[model samples]
Target: MTGFQNILTLYRENATTLLIVIVFIFTFSNNYICKILPLS
Candidate 1:
């Protein structure tokens, strides 16, 4: 049971980190693309 609980916490942490990374990537890419698009 203790090992399972540990895994759950680790998974939660990884999920949050992954979410942050995904958001960062989207934001960065959008800004970069906007800069490259002069028609916008």
Candidate 2:
């Protein structure tokens, strides 16, 4: 039980970090693409 809880905690923390990184990358790529494309 203790080991399972520890794994769960680590998974939660890593998931949060991964989510933030994904959002950051998505926002960054969106802005980069907008800059490259001509405005309508």
For TM-score, the strongest prediction is 1
Alpha-carbon deviation at 3 in model 2, angstroms? 0.8
Model 1 backbone overlap count:
0
Candidate 1 wrong stretches, greater than 4 Å: none
Q: Write candidate 1's Cα lDDT for 1-40 as tens digits.
A: 9999999999999999999999999999999999989977
Q: Which window of 10 residues has the lowest lDDT sum in candidate 1?
A: 31-40
- The residue pairs found clashing in candidate 2 are none
- How accurate locally, in lDDT, is each candidate? 0.98, 0.97
RMSD of 2: 2.0
lDDT per residue (tens digit) for residues 1-40 in model 2? 9999999999999999999999999999999999889864
RMSD for all candidates, in order, please: 1.8, 2.0
